[model samples]
Each structure stands twice: as structure tokens, then as C-alpha cells.
Target chain A: MQLSAGARREGSPWTGVWAVFLKEVADHLSSTRMRILEVLILLSAVGAVYAGARTLQQTVSEDPFLLLQVFTAAQDPLPSFVAFLSFFLPLAAIALGFDAINSEYNRNTLSRVLAQPIYRDALLWGKFLAGLATLALILLALFLLVVGLSLIFLGVPPNTEEVARALLFLLATLAYAGVWLGIALLFSVLFRSAATSALAAIAVWLFFALFWGIIAQLLAQAVSPYDPFRPESELRQAEALVAFSRVSPNTLYAEAIQVLLNPAVRSLGPVLITQLQGALLGSPLPLGQSLLLAWPQLTGLIALTLLLFALTYVLFQRREVRA
Target chain B: MVIETQGLSKRYGKVVAVEDLNLRIEAGEVYGLLGPNGSGKTTTILMMLGLTEPSGGTVRVLGLDPVREPLSLKKQVGYLPDSVGFYSEMTAWENLAYIARLNGLPRAEAEARIARVLERMGLAEVAHRPVSAFSRGMRQRLGLAEVLLKEPKVVILDEPTLGLDPEAAQAFLQMIQGLKAEGITVLLSSHLLHQVQAICDRVGLFHKGRLVLEGRVEELAQRVLGGAYRIRLGASPLEGLQARLQALPEVSRVSLEDGEVRLEATQDVRPLVARTVLEAGAALHSLALEKPSLDEVYARYFQEVRHAA
Candidate 1:
């Protein structure tokens, strides 16, 4: 500052945000629990790839479901290994993210971090970005490992089109995890305890991934049992159930990936009887075309995740850091 | 205002953490905010740092409104909480380097400054050790090292001597006196009277969330404590010496004992005292003037310490 009157003082940037971000990343990576969680997630991803490979072999021998496809890659389940991953990958993603924000608050570090030159938005976004980075690295490693295994077992590497489709699947699943990460952080900021946040997030996951479908099925049956087996009512009941399933992000991701992989799955309705149903009625688009058709579902999932993340930012800004 | 507060209050639901506090601490002076447990010392610090909003009036620090300019104000300040914690898994060098990075210290300078501060705080021996293994005193030193790494314009520390042994605490005070020599303002907060009394240029007394008293240590003592002088007589085998001393106007009270006299004077009358004892044919053995006890003055404000007993 100049000594004379009316002289202007120099300004400073908010380096506090960067400081807090580095501190948080350090804290998370420094813990043994982080390593344990990392190993657990990768082990599950590897386990899924193994299971998917086994399933692909059995299906190929018996022509299970008599599924057929136009492209050679689509002749069997696409992503040959990702089919296994989709089953348990959310657990890995959830474990990494469920308590990211809440646990910091629980440990009383959030207040200390923000007491620096940092703003609330930076703290929330920094943690999200760091966590998402960690999650992505794990997922990418598993993706590469799955591809290696598929090449080893099937004796053929994926073609360009197959590779593009597989990358899209991976991206879609990441977006799915991003949405849940945002949701988890929101809950974390809302709750003061890591245990509470983890429990609440896992409970929500159970509801969407498994229990929600069962409850919806029971509700749909009680509401209108219009016997979709009858050709007259087949379209309406199938449409109702499929629309209901799409309400779940898990359902959307699963259906989008399944349709992308299997050309014979014309509709993800009451059952996987559609490939065989070609002998009886009809089929929809080929696998690639079906993937393109499911683009909106993928977009919706990504949009929802981004929206949840934005809400978390707003709530974090409103919170007072007194710790 | 370098720092100002008017009727600022804070409450945690049913508990009023701080209520109706009004204080003004000016620039270029070491201000001590002294209070006991739950007296709202930390609450006031949090508000001043913009970590928590005040429930009542306004507060301004460094000529920027704390709430309105938190981002700017924080950049100009360094704070050390009572329970100082750091990235425990990182080495001291790594910890200080990371904080310096966050503060946008230029690369070469940040490393150099970290080294300087680590050496200054006497942490050079264990600079490479992870803070997880740091002793309590070592951790406190590391915390001070982090704040000093940036050379902030205003350094705020709460109970800085809490975990330090006498040698370390004395060294800490000397370091703060060095900051004062640089003309940087500091807020040295502690509940202990002697801690603040030792180094602070001025002290603010906090009781029940309000700043009940504030001034320079000597000035407040004189105003609140009045003046006192202790006079002890020796070799007083001379006859009628106690009665002769009590006969003086300056003496408010007098006590007599074996070969000595204790006088609590209402005014400075050392000359009269010496003359009276000598004229009475007794030697004046010892006389010591004392500063007013902050402990006594502070207890009067709390009114809970039995009114100075």
C-alpha cells in the first residue's frame, strides 16, 4: 500500500480454496481405510468380469435364449466383461463416495479447512472432483483389465465399433456413479455422522437397485393386472411396466447397457423372452441401433447426477462453518 | 476499522454462547482477548474470522467487513485454534509446503520460508517426521510454523501456550514479541491472566460473552485496582514504633507483629514511611511497591470468584 492518502491497496486471490482442496485430497489418500475401500472395489470389478466371462461361455454353447446379432461383437453379450461389472460396480462407486463429505464433517476437519481463505463452493467441488478422480481411475483400471481378460479368453480384441460402444458404456456408468456421488455428498453435508450418511446412502441404493423394482412390480400387479400375455393387452401392460422400470436410475442404466449389448432384446419388459419371441411375434432394432435409441436414458441419468451435484453446492454454501 | 464489534452476539439454540459483545481493537497493537472456558473467546474468534455469522451486531476486521469480505479478510490473516490439528500423515515439511502452496506462495520462496519457519520454531530436527508422531509440544510448534510461513499481517492464536512447557511458552512469547517488532498486529488470546499479561500491549477481558473490560495492562490495573504499597519494618525493638507509624495520615491500616510492621498504604508515602520509622529510632528494612493483580481485577468482573476474597 502507498503511504499517501487516497492510494489504492493491492488485491489478493482466494488461495484458500486451493489450500483446502489439497488438504482434503491428502486426508483421503493418507488413510488406510481409503486403501481398503479401493482394493474392495477393484476386487468386485474383477469378480464381475470373471462371472460375465463364464456366463458368456455357457450361453454361447447352448445358444442360451437363442439370441442373435448382426455384428460379430454383438453375437455374444457386448462388453463381454462389463456385463459382469454392471452387477456390482455401483457398490464400489458407492463405497468410495458415500461418506466423502459427511465423514469430513464428522471428523471436524471441514470447519478447519474452510477456516482458511476457502469458500464453501470450492470445498464441496474440490472433494467431488478429487473423489470422482479417484473413482474414475479405479473404474478405468478395471475397464482395461476386463478388456485384457476378454481378449485372452475370446482370442479376439474388440473392433473399432465394439471399442466405441464399450467406451460409451463405461462413460455412462461413470455418469451414473457421479449422480450417486453427488447424492451421497448432499446427504453427507446434511448429516453430521459418517455412519449415518453411509447407511442412508446404502439404504437408498438398495431401494433403487433391488427393492424398488420388487415394490413396483407388486404395486403394478395390484393396480392393473391386465394380463400382458394376451396379444390384445400385451403392448399396454409391457409399456406400463417398462415405463415404471425407467423411473429407477439403476433400471435405466441396466436397460441401456443390456439393449446396447444384445440386439435381440427388443424391449426390456416382463422378461428376457423377446429373442425367442421372434419365432412368435417381432423384434426391434439391432444392438447398435438400440443403444442409440437408449441415448435419452443415458442423457437423463447424466443430467440427474449433475443436478444433484449443483444442489449439493447450494446447500454447502448456505451451511455455516463453526467447527 | 482494523477490528470492531458492536453488540455482537451468538447463540447455539438454548445456550447463549456469546451475548451483546461490543469491542474495538485498533491497528498495530497486540490485543489480548482473555476469557475462561465457555466465556466466548473462541466464539468471538470464529466470528472475526468469518467462519460463523454473528447473531447480533456488526464486526469489521482489517477495514473489510468480516461477513461481507470474508474471502478478502481471510487472505490477510492467520489463525491458530486451541486444538491445532494438521495433516497427520504428512511430514512437517510436506504439511507446511502444502499450506504455503494453498496460500499461493511462489515455489522457491514457499520452500525457503517453510525451512526458515521450521528452523525458527525449532522443528528442524523433526521436519521430516510425519506429524502423526509429533508430541503435543512439537505439534504446537508445527502449527505456529505454518502460520509464520506466510508472514501474515495479523496473527491470531488461541491458547497458544496450552500444550507448551515453560521454556517453549517463553520462546513462543519471544517470537510474538519479534512479530511486534515488525509492527504486525497480533491477537494473543488466553484465559490465563499471566499469559496475556506477559506480552500483550493491551488486553480485553471477556466474561459471559461480553467484553467487560479492556485497556492497556498497566492502565486497567491502576484504574480497577487503585494503588497499593507494601511496607515492612525491621529491627523494631524501639518503643512505640507501631503506634507512631499508624499515627500518620497516609496509612489506611497498620498491623504490628514481632519486630516488624506491615502497612497497606492508601497512597504513595514511602518517604514519610521511611522518615517515621527512622525518626522513631528503627531501621526501615524492606519496602516493595506492587502492580495491581490482574487476577484480582478480573475476578471482580466475573463476580463469581468470591469478590477477590
Candidate 2:
């Protein structure tokens, strides 16, 4: 019944959410934490792109999509631009949002803020939109910078399809960052201390980024045992392992980017030799097919973000706001 | 009524913060809620603001149910919490501007109102200074400025003078009177009886989550103590003056200590007592009618209720 009231009222017009959104955006932009994270991300991105551009030069004469390799190619001691993004985007998002709600509570300004004529829906939505906007802006800038640097280094402009695919990859990366931001926001709502929320968010990121692949491997070994006795069982075990790992947003991001950036990769799982008999060995798939391949991963990231956001909205609305 | 509550109650699981409370405040009246700690003053204020849903009953402000029309109601009602906290990193003007935007004021109008309120609260010089550098009194004044930003019809303040020095408290009380003169309904809550007694037109004494006594300060004191008069004699050792005062039929009871005589009388017996003191060879320095103080009234009323229960 409360949810229905909330839902019905959700349609009612609110003018103040935008004010909160603008203020929050300004606050996030001016924060020292965001500044530090921005600097760190820029340094890593520039390093990774420079490293990848140098490696792409060797294959520039034959490869028509040489610039696309700036996002995927990696040499020793440095990963690609996309790789650095996959590693640092979540950190930036969590840094931006880990104290989004709790900081207001701790500062004793939340109750006063809510006491204004605005509804709680506006407050939560505004903060979320501001954070997402900040993340999107930063991601867009970094993607353009990488593209520009690659354009100069590789001396080959990307074709329409390649540009489209890179843009899609950037969009996917934003969604992945959104998922982590939502997780961090959920922690912010659940904990009163900013330090606690920050620690919880990092703990979750560490689990997914560092330990999840190993855990999924161990889980597959335990559940779908490797019976070397049966050759088919090996494929099933590997499939089980990938399936388990897909639950982590990191895995989804990596898989989605691989599909978008590498058009030669047609499937996320193993394919039979007979199934690929007529397929061109190294020809890149069309952009539409790649998007179709990455659609499920993109949907997974979006759903996770939505689920976290919904939880935050409901909890924040029902809370007393006494602090 | 500017504000009305019908059988309002809030139960936090097993603990009832406020219960079966009914209050009616007319327009332009300064109503003070007087109670000790844990007496449900804050709970009542929260319920009235529609911040916390009541377990039973309803609250109406400006003829609109706060729960049903909280935004509309809040637009007309300004509230100052016991301890006001602003965004420390922001300047006072910036903080007020943020609240103004949230309240749906136009940018130009908000700027004008922010400047006006800052000047009125004597913070115009420091309007651009960060709130973190403000003292407690300055913060309290800034809080008042924030409350007045919207030109609200009703203002609810919870212990607006909680941490102020004596001089600052006096200034804050004077500003509250200014609010009253502007025809705004103010519902203030505080445990400082004397301060409330000074500015409040009518007072409600809350005990154990219930409104035990509600009336004007002087009327409540008279109602509780029955017109008892305290007379302070000029010199000590008024040994026979006490007996003579007790013998007068108008005086119902008499007690003497430290050159002061406290007498309970059903009517004004000051003239009769003065005559008796003079005839008894005792100098009558001062004789005045003494109604019970608001502090005594609160204490005695709470004690009687405790004893009865």
C-alpha cells in the first residue's frame, strides 16, 4: 500500500528535484575525492593509451581498424585504455557515491534538506542523477581523449562501424560503472558512517574484481566435477565456470567490451568446429551482430543498477529522516 | 486553527514517544511546548511536520492534512531544530540559496530574500563566510535567517535557544517576539521554563508523553497555586509577625524563614497583613501579591500527577 502511494505520487510533478540535482552535481565536481580520482584515472588512461598506441603501430600497414586496437591491444607492463577503464571506472564511481546519503546524515543537513517543500523522491533521484551524470561526463571525456590520442599515433581514422562499436563500448563501460555506483549508494544508505560505506564498497569491489574468478573456478570444479574420463565433461565444466563468473559485474563488463571491441569474437562461450566451418576465420562481424552478442551482458549490468537504485529509493522514502 | 492535532500518537515498537495528544493553535499565537527531556516534544513536532507518520490520529497545518499534503504544508511552515546544522563547507548565502531553491523560490527572488534575511539576522558582513567558522550563536542566528527565508505563515522552533549564552538567548527571544508581531503562528518547544515563560503567550506542559497542563503562564500558575502570596519583611527575627499573620482570618496558611513569610490566601490580604505587621511592632518593608512562578507551577503539577498515579 505504501509502495502504491509512492508509485502513484511518483507521477505527480516535482519541480525541486532539479535544484537538488544541480547542487549535488556542483558538490561532486568540487569534491577533493572526485578531483583525486579524476587525476588518477587520467594518468592511468593516458599511460594505457600511449602504451597501446605504440604497439598498434607495428600492425598499422595491414589493419584497417588499427585505432580500435587502442582499446584492446596491450604490451608488457601496460594494458589497453579499456583495460585501465575497467579497473578504475568502478573506483571513481564508488568514490563519487559511497558517501552520497550518509555524508548528509552525518553533517546533520539531511533532515533540514528534507524539511524543505521537496519530496524524498526528488532528493534521492536528484543525487543519483547527479552522480550518474558526473560519471558519464568523465567517461565521455576519457573516451574522446583516448580516441584522439590513438588517431594521432596510429595515423588511421576509424571507419563508421568501428567508431560506432567504440562508442557502444563506452556506453557499456558507463553502465558497468553505474552498477558499482549503485552498490556504493546502497552501502551509503545502509551505513551511517562514510568510512563504513567506503570500506564496504571496496570490499565488494575487491571480491568481484580479484577473487570472483577464482571462486567461480573453484565452484565449477566442485559442482561440475572435471571428469577427464569424459571429454564432454571438460567443456561442461568450463561452461559452468564462465556462467558462475558472469554474476560479477566485472566479468560482464569484460565480456561485453570484448564483444564490442573485438568483432572477430562471435560468441562468449566455446563453439564446435563444425558450427564455424563456413564462417570467415578472421573477418570482423558487423556492428549489429556484436551488439546482439553483448546485449545480455549490457542488460545484466543495467538490471543490477536498477535493482540497487530501487532499493535505495524505497528505503530512503520510508526512513524517518530524524538525523 | 493554524495547527491542529487530533489524538496524535507515535509508537516506536514498544516505546510510545507521544500518545493521544490533541493540540489546537490559533493563527498569530505563540504557543510554547514546555517539558523535560524525553517528554515527547520533538515527537510531536516531527508528527506535525509530517516527517514521521503517526501510529494513530492526524495532523493538520494551515487547514491541510500534513500527511496528505506535506509539500504544500511544508511550504508554509518553517522549522528550526534544537541544534541547527548547515553545510559547513558552504557560505551562509550559498546555504540559504540552496534551501531557497528547494522551496521552489525563483533564483532572483531567492537571492533577494537571502540577502534580506542575512542582513536582518546581523550576518550580512559574514554572508560570504563559510558556516564552519561561525560560532554557536551565529549559527543560531543563521538558522533563524533560514527559517524566515520563505516568509512562512507558521514557524516551529525546537529549543531555539538551547546553547546560546544569556545575551544571545535574550536576543533570540526578542527576535521570536518580532516573528509574533508579524502575525506568524509559532510553536516553540523547550525545557527552559523561564525562557518560555518570558516569550510564550500560552504554554503546554508535557510529561511522560502526555500534555499534563495547558494554559497561559499566569493563568496556569494561578490555577495551580491558588493565589498564594510571598511577603519579604525588612529585617530578620520577625518572631511575632508570623503568629499575627496566621491569626488573621484572611490568611489560610503561614510560614516564615530568612526574613520572608509565605502565606496562602484565598483573596488579596496584603493590606490586612501590612496592618497586622505594623500593629505588632514589626517594620513592613514590602508586601506584594505573589502568584506561583511558572517553574513552581510545572514542578508542583508534575509532582501531583506523579503522586496521583
Candidate 3:
């Protein structure tokens, strides 16, 4: 065989990304773990929407954004739809991604897959995108279910502003889920064992979800000591607390949802008495103002997701394919 | 050459995995890389596939640099790793289809090639059965089927027959011979000498991250054993038989054990030995000539290397 060196071919690094993405998405959707999480999220969403709509129907009041309230209004035992989502969305995202890369290593498939004519970039991106797409599909279904239930119970069609705010809320929720997915993927790449990666992802989630608030409070107090004699110290300490807590993705998601879902949420930080002067006390802010208020939080969630994914990409590329 | 490497080396921190290696394999030949585990055969294969970067030197496969033009190199080269794995939940066809897609085969073409390769590997009967239910031999065949899906010009198999039973290992060797018959350049790494000896055209022996020996099997046996044949003579009146056989022109050495005369000869001296036995009035019970076995060649070469060290 007379063979000469062919000219260097510049095939795109994304050559096989779509194939990987399709396979991963199929695996995630068909998995039993995802089915269980889907059932849990669906039940909570139905229960929360039922309770919130019941409450709204009893109250003979003129609330323009009654549809939005179905997501935020809490009953005696059941938290609102948004609350349920905030609690379970991270778990769902982590479940989809915790074993993404490590399972390939465990099964001894990484080397075989890498041996194909594709860059490592394609595999990592494909897995991450598939995870994000799965989360989006589930969240979208849940949102529509809540909306349909609210319309039936409250006998009210959501206004344009309500629909817009709800859409933004959904986007923020997806970004929130993306952050946890990124965390799970990063752990999956860092640890060789699937159990270890899952544990590490859950540890991160628990820190931000349950322990971060207390830790942030303590840190703020230590940084800005409160003094009874100086009233301004109280405001300074509150500012410090907000700054410290915002580092957690959970805090960012919560703040973003507050502004997006609750148009009456004027600010996320301490408000001075003078700053509230001449403001319409009871009126809801316009959709634009609400989005502007939540812009920093929304961007923070996206940045955290990107940063985590970038770190995972670098680590996975540098890693050896051998098990 | 289909695959060539010059001054190739790999070091993992303080430990040298492969050091200053030069290897060349021609097209349409089955080249066996023989080594015990951790002798750098797998690492060298990885470097050639661009799956692992070499710490020094260069590799070219099918006239393309594995590092600089990996996609092009990989498209023409198929690598079946040791203990190869697939998504067990997926069917045999699904697993192969995924590999075909990664090679950027069109949907119809991918399906066709998958069907063809599965049939070729004798997996057509269970094409839709999940791989988890497959036995070890079946999985190894499926691994080969995956490699053949690309219709590669060169195929590299690492420890392809490691855990197979004797019957299955023999069957796998026949498949490798089939590949060679189709003019595919094959590089297979294995520690099992006799099994691969039937299929490999040439072999390189690896020891402690170095290519200690490389040549045809018979040539290696000649160089290491100092002769290629062992002739055993069973004769009555074994007295003076050892010195007599030792003095023969064709024989290199002679020994007497268990009332039998054993002689290492450069060629077949059976006729001469028989004539001498009859003239001496010795009854020749059984006389046999043994071709040099690779197992013996490997053992003797290592023994010599050990003694030298």
C-alpha cells in the first residue's frame, strides 16, 4: 500500500457532540432514578397549586397576579410550588450528573469512546447539555401543570405581565438547576468512584441549602460587629450578611425567584427609610423593573454554572482515559 | 509502514512507563506486542492512538501523526482496549450504532455497517439483546465488531484474548487471521505467547518498558535458543550416546536424561542419528524432533536477560 500523509483535516471539535447528547438524553429520560424524581416533583407541584388556588378562591380580593400566587402562596402543611421546586430541583440535577463521567470510567467505556474520531470537548459538552436539556424538559412540564391547575381552580386567565414574569421565573429556575448540574459534573470528573462523586455533589448542595445561611450569618457578625449605640451598625451588619450569603448559589436562586415571581419584592437588601420615600407602597413594580432588580442574581447563577463547567472541562481533558 | 514510532518515551513522575522506544509495523502484517503486564505495551498503543500523549518523541499511523492529526488517524485506525466495555443497558446494535455515529457515518450507512459488522462477529442473532446478558467471549467479539464498524485500515487490540477460554481464544485468533487476510495491519498486545504465535507475522518482546527483542518467531528462537530444533532420541544402550550426539556436526548440544538422549540441533539430523543407532546395534524405541515453541523461546530469552542483569 503506497500511502502518503494526507493534508491536515480541520474537523470540528463538535463533530460527535449531537450523537452523545442524544444518547445521554435517552438514558437520563429512561432511567428509573429520573422517574422517581419526576413523580416526586409532580406530586408536590399538584399539591402546592391546589392549596394556593383554594386559598385564593376563598379570599374575595382584587389581586392582579393571582396566577403567580399559586407558585408562592404557602398553605398550612404544603409549601408553595416555588418552594418545592427550590428544594427538589438541585437533587434532580445532581442525580442526572453525579455519575456522568465516572460511570463511563467504571464501565471501562471512556477509552473506547475517546478512541473514536472526536475530541474530548464533544463528550463533555454533550453530557452537560443533555443534562441541562433534561432538567428544562421536566421543569417546563411542571410549570405548565401548575398553570393549568391554577386556571381551573381560580377561574382566571393569567394577564400578559403575569405570563411574562412566569416565563422569566422558569428561566431563572433552569439556571438554578444548571448550577447544581455543573457541580455534579465537576465532582463526577474529579472522583473516580460514582459513589464518591454523588456524595461530594450532595455535600455541596447541603452546605449551600441548609448550612450556608448560618455560616454566612456568623461570618457577617464577625466582620461587622453590631453596636446598640450606633444604629448605623445594624444596617452595616445586614449589608455584610447579604454579601456573605450571596456567594451561595442557593441564595442567588432564591433572590432571583423572589424578584421574578413576586413583583412586590422591592429590593433584596436593606432599604433605608429615605429611599422608600415617594414610592408606591402597595403597587407591584413593572415587569422591567422586576427583571432589572433580579438581573444581578440571574447573572450570578449563570456565571456559577459556566465557571463550574469550565473547571470540569479542563480537568476531564487533562485526565487519562485509562481506567 | 502503517505505524511508526521513533524515540518514544513516557514517564509518570518518577516512574518511567516506556523509555526510548522505536517501533515500526508494515501494512498487511499482524504484529504481536508480547510483554507481561505493566511492560508498557498498552501505553505504547495509547500513544499511537493519541489516547495518551508520549512524554518524548513522535508516532505516525497511516502516514498521519497521531498527536497532530488524531481525528484523521483515528478514523482509519480502530483500537479495542483491554477488558473493553459498553453501556450494558444498550443492545449490541445500539452500542455499535453509537460508535458508527461517532465516526460520523450517516444514519442509513451507520445502520448498514452495524448490521454487517454484527453479522460478521456472529452477533446477528442477539443484535437487540442488552450487552449485560452477554458472556465474556461474546463481549470480546462485540468489541471486535465495534472496531470493524469503522472498516479501519489498521486495528490495534490490547490483550484481546486475556480472559478467554482455550476454545474461545482459538476462535478469536482465527478472527485475527481473517483480519490479516483482508490486508488489515494488526497490532495486538498480549502476554500469552502460544495463542498469538499462530497469527502474528512478527513480534516485539517488551521488558521493563523497553523493547528487548523484535523479530520473526523462528528467528528469535534461533537467536535465543542457539538452535531452532530439539531432537529427542530414545535408544537402547544409551551409553556413549551423549558424547556421540554432541560430536555430530549439526548438533549444538546433547544431554542424557531419563534413559533418553536429547540433542539441540541447528537442523533436522534424524536420518543421521537413526543410521548411527542402527550401526551401533541399539534399538531405537522412539525418535522425535521438536520444533522450537515460543513459550520455550520466551523463557530462555528472559533467562539469558536475567543472567546478564
**Highest-TM-score candidate:** 3
iRMSD of all candidate structures: 4.9, 2.6, 2.3
Model number with the top DockQ: 3
Q: Best candidate per lDDT, number?
A: 3
Q: Deviation in angstroms for B306 in model 1?
A: 9.5
lDDT of 3 at B86: 93
> Model 3, range A46-74, lDDT digits (tens) per residue?
89888797778788978989888899998
Predicted candidate 2 versus true structure: per-residue lDDT over A208-291, tens digit per residue: 989998999999999889887999899899899999999999999999999998988898877878898888988989889999
DockQ of each: 0.35, 0.58, 0.69
Query: lDDT tens string, model 3, B54-144?
Result: 8998888988887778898899899999989999999999999889888999999999889899899999999999999999999999999
The clash count for each model shown is: 0, 0, 0
Each candidate structure's TM-score, on Cα atoms with residue i matched to residue i, is 0.80, 0.94, 0.96
Give the Cα error of residue B29 in candidate 3, in Å.
1.2
- The alpha-carbon deviation from the true structure for residue B221 of candidate 1, after best TM-score superposition, in angstroms, is 1.9
The best-first sequence of candidates by DockQ reads 3, 2, 1
lDDT of model 1 at residue B248? 88
Q: Write the per-residue lDDT of candidate 2 for residues B164-225, one digit (tens) a residue.
A: 99899999999999999999999999998887688899999998899989989878866776
The lDDT of model 1 is: 0.71
User: Candidate 1: where are CA atoms >4 Å away?
Assistant: A1-84, A102-112, A221-247, A268-292, B11-16, B228-289, B304-309
